[model samples]
Target: MDFWILAIRIIFLVQNTTGIPGNFSLLFYYLIVYQKECILKPTDLILMHQMAANTLIILSAGVPQTMAVWGLKQFLNHLECELILSIQRFGRSMSICTTCLLSIFQAMTISSRKFCWKDHIVKAVKYIGCYISLIWVLYILINFIFCVYALIKMDNKNVTRDFGYCSIIENDKIIEILYAALVMCPEFFFSVLIAWSSGFMIVILYRHKQRVQHTMSTHGSSRNSPEFRATQNILALMSTFLAFYTLSSISRGCIALLYNHSWWLMIVNQFISLSFPSFGPFVLMNHYSNISGHILVWIRNKIHFILF
Candidate 1:
């Protein structure tokens, strides 16, 4: 195997191995283990949904791509190809929407009582499940457009363009651009929403920090506070999502524009695109106090049992 191809396989192996299990563990912890401890909060529900989505997303796109990289040609049939891509895209969009909702919900929770939407926002959490269901249906409809264009053709030796295991044969630039726009429009909107909500939370946190500092200069007290930690987690979540999303978008755009598409570039683009989904669960889980604490206690008990 070529060095680059070997590298791609290693990357995919590590990513799917780690990401799939990590997401499943998170989903199970939140849905089952954590429930044994306390009632599921809206934030926990959102994160659980995101974990499930990320797992499916990785399995749909990452698995097939990996198989193809190892020289398995036409890894998917026409119907399977279209279905996988549609599901992957749908999962990705749902992840974005849920992240945006999470940020906005956190902001509302931390904002001053005087804030205009305080009461309304408080009520919104009660209907989070309904909202999540609506988002799932909406994205499924939005991505059904993929089924129209996605086709499985025998891997042609002469063809150099590598969109995916499947192919889209669009000769017209206008139609291609329109198709791209239709696919990306929802993601762009959700990205903007995440940014806005994150920004609002930052302002609120900054003001709160200033007041806390004025009262007491000790860093430990302020940093260890539940509210402060929640803010940190939200900021980290937003940063990771935006950073990976932007990099992936740019790389994908370059792939579209380049006449001679470099396979390495596409592989790199796939890695970047998969970054947030694959790693996002770990990020939130690390910062979530209750979950992390429970994990630690469980680990210590396991160690104790083994040693004794």
Candidate 2:
């Protein structure tokens, strides 16, 4: 009924409407349509995993947060809350991990030609599936512990902290600190990796640009190379992720530490958390012109059919 609540609901509605379909379209293209034309690369696999995780985040966290803001009360029971939050955590964790991995992979890919460790990088690419599966398993176990703790804690009547649509158990100071460390430490480490890789990419691109300027004949070919283009895209992706993730983390930390559950801050935090998942697919689509072309053709065909 309030103006801010109405605006927040509209924001969430737009985010969910765009984010879900964008992620699914990317996922479908990568999983099914990609291999038909060209050999699927390790980067493609990582992007697929990241998109899948983004979809999970939007569905589990974004949808529930939207419902909560729309005046839904106690829509989720304790068990459901645990399950949804666990899935959301898992998705968020995997999204961070995959982004880090993607940056590292692109850096390696661009540098492998000049380094003596080219074979090693090739071998690592061969086992990318194993790496992704291991990451999935690790996050699943960690979030399973989180779910179990929430379930056990929910049984205690005195410690429950209620959000509008869902609830979680409040823990003691020690447990709270431990959980915070558990979540933040790994994210910080991954953030560092992403920064390092992004820096590496920028250096490479800068050097390449210098070389291109000195030799105009090969400029177009070098600039059009797959490695160069992918490095650029990964750098863009990392920038977007860090920008949104930092804002989301700061807002969440403020909420947790200050116990300031103001409506505006909560809405801001939710919007920041959903920002990447909502817009990241378009970033990738821009890099892969073929995907954008397909989307355009699909839209034109539909319009033509309607006109006829």
> All models: lDDT?
0.76, 0.84
Clash numbers, per candidate? 0, 0
The residue pairs found clashing in candidate 2 are none
Deviation in Å, model 2, residue 232 alpha carbon: 0.7
55-162: candidate 1 lDDT, tens digit per residue: 878998888777777777675665676688678878888878888888888877777464787677767877888999998887777667555543422232234344
Output the lDDT of residue 101, model 2: 92
Q: Flag clash pairs in model 1.
A: none
Model 1: lDDT to the true structure: 0.76
Model 1, 142: alpha-carbon shift in Å? 2.5
Off by over 4 Å in 2: 34-39, 173-178, 217-223, 294-308
User: What does each candidate score in C-alpha RMSD?
Assistant: 4.5, 3.5
* lDDT of predicted model 2: 0.84
Q: Residue-wise lDDT of candidate 2 within 1-308, one digit each (tens)?
A: 58867888899999999999999988877755564656578988899999999999999989988888778878998789889878988999999999999999888889887877688788888899899999999889888987786666665646665666787777667556666677779988998999899998899999997887777765545444777987888888899999999999999888887664776776788799999999999898888879866656666876999999
**On a 0 to 100 scale, what is the lDDT of residue 70 in model 2?**
78
